[model samples]
Target: MADSESGGRPALARRLAAEAVGSMLLAALVVGSGIAAVQLSPDQVGLELVENAAATAAGLFAIILMVGPVSGAHFNPVVSLVDAAFGGLSWRDAAAYLPAQVAGCVAGAVLANLMFDRSAVSIASHHRASGAHLLAEVVATAGLILLIFALARSDRAERAPAAVGAYIGAAYWFTSSTSFANPAITVGRMFSDSFAGIAPASAPAFIAVQVVGGAVGYGLVRLFYPPTVAPGRLVSDPRRQADAPHPSRERSTLR
Candidate 1:
């Protein structure tokens, strides 16, 4: 049977669909874990931290491995936006991806709340907007984007999927903001009063820092490794430019 969306089968569309669905489910897992952890044992600070970190790590790894090929596994909008800014993705794709991520994150939060038998969790209740916390958010989110783009630009994304997970897991423990690198995720997480939630009021501060950090990371990428235009207008290879396609060839072939 022909698919309704395209009036026939479409592999590219199907792949993108799968990526969106997979990313949503991954976000749900993170929210679910946070809600369950808080509901079951809200006061166990040490234990809850461990559980949350483990759960987030597992979900992140799954997302990267599952959708890495489909959509580059960009579950975070900031990462997608930054990549688009760098000319890695089209503005159209970025436009779609940003809203998809936000919706996925919100859905995850809602699902987590339902599972925990609560309408809302009071996460991020305290210690959200202080100087140190803001700084932590900046540094943590910056590191996350830096690691992702750096690996991708270096042609190592396929090899180091696990590093993304590890980086996030470690950031939770090391950074003061607990590594809320994703604005959408943070907003959704705030809906739940779980270990992962940040107060809704504090969302803007964290977001500001995260944006700054992402820009800094992008600037750094441009500085040490400048981009060049290939003869065919294709992106320049980070490792070498000599083998890039010639734009003239592309035009002649099309014509």
Candidate 2:
């Protein structure tokens, strides 16, 4: 069972707090570093992108390490949904996580702007809408989800921090949309006018594409790692001495 299940209210609260704080710090890092990069490399767009990506990748690794134990470190709503779908999280808690993630992201963007001495809630002017951009969002989000669950199913969950960070860093350069694969962060980016921000008008398409990507990723997971039993049913290897009978066998025996 998840820690939230066993520990109840206190655990849930702690997890929510971790998600909020972690998401806030992530947005701060993204926007602040983008601002700093632009100031430091004024005319060099590539150099600024390099600086921003590197900072974000490193910051993400650290944040996940710090918060993963608490909230599964899901700063992204799609990730929370996928986790719940896979039985790693309960739907009730997952429902709660979405609002927290979105709210935290918005607050984080405002805080980032304030820290950089800008208006706290300026609407982003960075227009990022195009057919290519929407396609990039889908690919970027799909790849992120696949990477995360692939690690989980393979029992390499411990490597997620480094792997996820690295993937995002690489995606920044490879994807046309600069890999804003996170829905919460995409919304957060709308509140800042820095290099990292996305225009408010462009956010809806990106978010919709991301949701589609998430569904595709989930379908891929089911295809590749088909579950051995129905939801809520346990299965154990018959080779193990303490194994319970298979559900079908148990039902037959009971009958």
Candidate 3:
């Protein structure tokens, strides 16, 4: 996952571009689907959630499948950071990926806004920072990381697409914060004043908790399932087939 640029690996530019494009599409899926759900379901919050969750989940699966091979389709900064921490990816590569992901998410958010006939950069008005919500973020993020590594170690990387999509979809219901377990997505959500948006004021706490949750997840992963491969080889390894569930293919959905 380093910038080794060897062993049939893609060049660094391709990987970064893939991350950006993948992340951009992911944000669009999230914000766009939420907008559609609001329009389609109106004030029926429950139904709206159902619609939003369904679309995000299904789209996540497709996105991952379409882009996983090129860049592991991380689409989440925490995922990339954790991958690097364990040497599944190089620090250099992971650092570069962070900006690409963030930028892609921002672009995606703008795209969603424009697509929905809204301003290009309206800040979110929804604030979600209750104690319970924060706790949910921790649980949601930790579970996501653990799940990813668990599949990799179990030699079920191929099953990751479905598993990941299913888990995120389920998390949307179980987690109080609706499982915004990804930092890039959290940032993207801030740019939209819609069903899936989070107010900027609450973003800091959410991002902080996500990082903390990531640490907890990696801690647990290290505790129970130590690394089997050497450094620079892991779940996000360019050579490793991208694992993580794709939602709709399973008759499902994550984001």
Candidate 4:
């Protein structure tokens, strides 16, 4: 059985809705918290980042738990692409998801700005372009993807929300670019001038490096968990009937 069939995949419209709404909420959390953090900790940059990271991590955990079932909660375009590449999602569905995620993120940024009494479409002035920044983006994105898929393959998908949230929180401090790790979020951040925003001039390089990181991460997944020669079989145990595949065989295949 296909993973979608066994797991009861929602309608495409429903899944798309979940993706959009989830992405919107995530962006709102990021931008709003950043704005609030800067205001609350005016002279303390470290305190501002701590507040922003805490809020973002908590928000991400909640959002993923809310929408993981519907659309795999892939607010990131590279994540959607990785799902498609690994056969957990179709290319057509991923294509639809990308635009929705991006649009929702953009809307969320605008909404956050409005809520904070700022212009809705102000391009960020915080320039974050540099070789070190681009390299940081690559490392951040690659680590994120690796962590997500690793948990998935290890039969720990249920732990993903917490793990992903924690990883992002840590990466925020460790990575030079504060781990934008997501192209949609990067673009959305371009519309805000708050603590979390990235300049328009910086978005492209960040996005490009993120994509490259995603590809490298996917390659690592393939390397570690090579495809099975037997397409639908979960195990090679002699006691188990080959004709009667495991219920989760298809889902496990992607792992």
Candidate 5:
């Protein structure tokens, strides 16, 4: 009853819609900001990065708040997959979220390019794959997964919006690849030849390490926040409230 009603097809449709739109907006913010950063801070690479990182961090926080209620605001494919693995989302729903997220990001890239008076679809020429960059992707993505699930499992999900935004902002400065921790965004960036763009050649390697990073994060979550050893019980245990969204409303956050 209640479970069926809450997670019924109609609800699924709404959630999918929310995921698509939220992801689109997220990509737009990231790519658009990168373009602005380059144009606004020409000849100052450091200043361009600062501007891009700041805008992305702030925009991510707001976007999560806007749609976290609807679809958990999982704008990233890795986040959606990991949430499914943790029993927060159904594998089926998680699977559906993949295409929506990727498509939304692709559309967003086009939108950003058009907004900047550029070609609608331009292949990025930026080649970012390097040994250190790959390693950094692993570190950045693993930390992201750990942060998100840590909040969910520890009943601190309410802080995810701000925390995720802050972490990504910091990562942009720390990670060599600017912490492109989201595969959907990584792909979305492939279509733009602007400041935020990643060459198509580099995307696969980045995405591969991101998956590895996701697995490592899963292990870390189990090690640090073991559900089997919960003193009271797992906060995100579906049996406790089957109809609840994986992280529930509070648990939902995006990067």
Candidate 6:
């Protein structure tokens, strides 16, 4: 089943609350699953990838459905940032969203660590920041931003909740990065030394790519989906009054 809701934006408090809760859930699922997969089958690359993909899909679907109505379900800072760039959201919203996402991610990772036992936290995993892995993260994140913006700008937001989850699952298979798609997720993953751990040094490159991807996606959406509805029309144009004929003149003309 899908986890989504109909129209209307949340107020600042509601949005922040949603972001906090959603990010926590997302982080715990991502890190917790990765930890479990490795412990279950340490050398099975295919199994790891498959489990990771499933975890991402399930966790994301749940978060979106649960918190989407409150915060647009933007658990990722990059997603929120891109939404802001595309004018789907405002700067004020972004200001509240980014920090909440990051903090929630860190908190979630720590919680997962506690759940799995501190000694098993996976923070020591060497696979966290290999160059190839970092590169994969960049490409995967870019694709995600593109997908998010395209779906959002399309006449299809109503259809997006499903498309987004499916697209992300597929992207994990195709993209070299297994579709991490979110810097916050990446950062949170670092707390685990399991199959998903990413080194701190590698984070900058990943964040750079994600931010660039978000901006590019926003630009692409703006290019293709120029709003057909004018803002002035939505709110009556005061200048339209200035151009109106005087009632006295109209009356004289009629006479």
- Which candidate has the top score in TM-score? 3
lDDT order, best first, reads: 3, 5, 4, 2, 1, 6
Give each model a TM-score.
0.79, 0.86, 0.89, 0.88, 0.88, 0.79
List candidate 6 segments past 4 Å from native: 1-8, 119-124, 127-135, 230-255
lDDT of 2 by residue, 183-217 (tens): 99999999998899999999999999999999988
As for lDDT, the candidate ahead, 5 or 6, is: 5
List the global CA lDDT of all models.
Answer: 0.65, 0.79, 0.82, 0.81, 0.82, 0.65
lDDT of 5 by residue, 75-121 (tens): 88888888777766778988999999999999999999999999999
Error of 5 at 211 (Å): 0.3
Candidate 1 Cα deviation (angstroms), residue 85: 1.5
Query: How many clashes show up per model?
Result: 7, 0, 12, 0, 1, 4
Candidate 3: where are CA atoms >4 Å away?
Answer: 1-4, 230-255
Candidates 2 and 5: which is better by lDDT? Answer: 5
Q: Across residues 1-255, which tens digit of lDDT does each residue of candidate 3 receive?
A: 555476646787988898999999999998999999989889999998898888888888888887776787888889898988876678898999999999999999999999999999999999999999999999999999888876766555666777778888889999999999999999999999999999999999999999999999999988988766433222244333233233322111111
Error of 1 at 91 (Å): 1.5
In the order shown, the candidates' Cα RMSDs to the true structure are 6.7, 6.9, 5.9, 5.2, 4.4, 10.9
The weakest ten consecutive residues by lDDT in model 5 span 228-237
The global Cα lDDT (0 to 1) of model 6 is 0.65
Relative to the true structure, candidate 1 reaches a TM of 0.79
The list of candidate 1 runs beyond 4 A from truth reads 1-19, 39-42, 120-127, 228-255
* Candidate 4 segments whose C-alpha is farther than 4 A from its true place: 1-7, 228-255
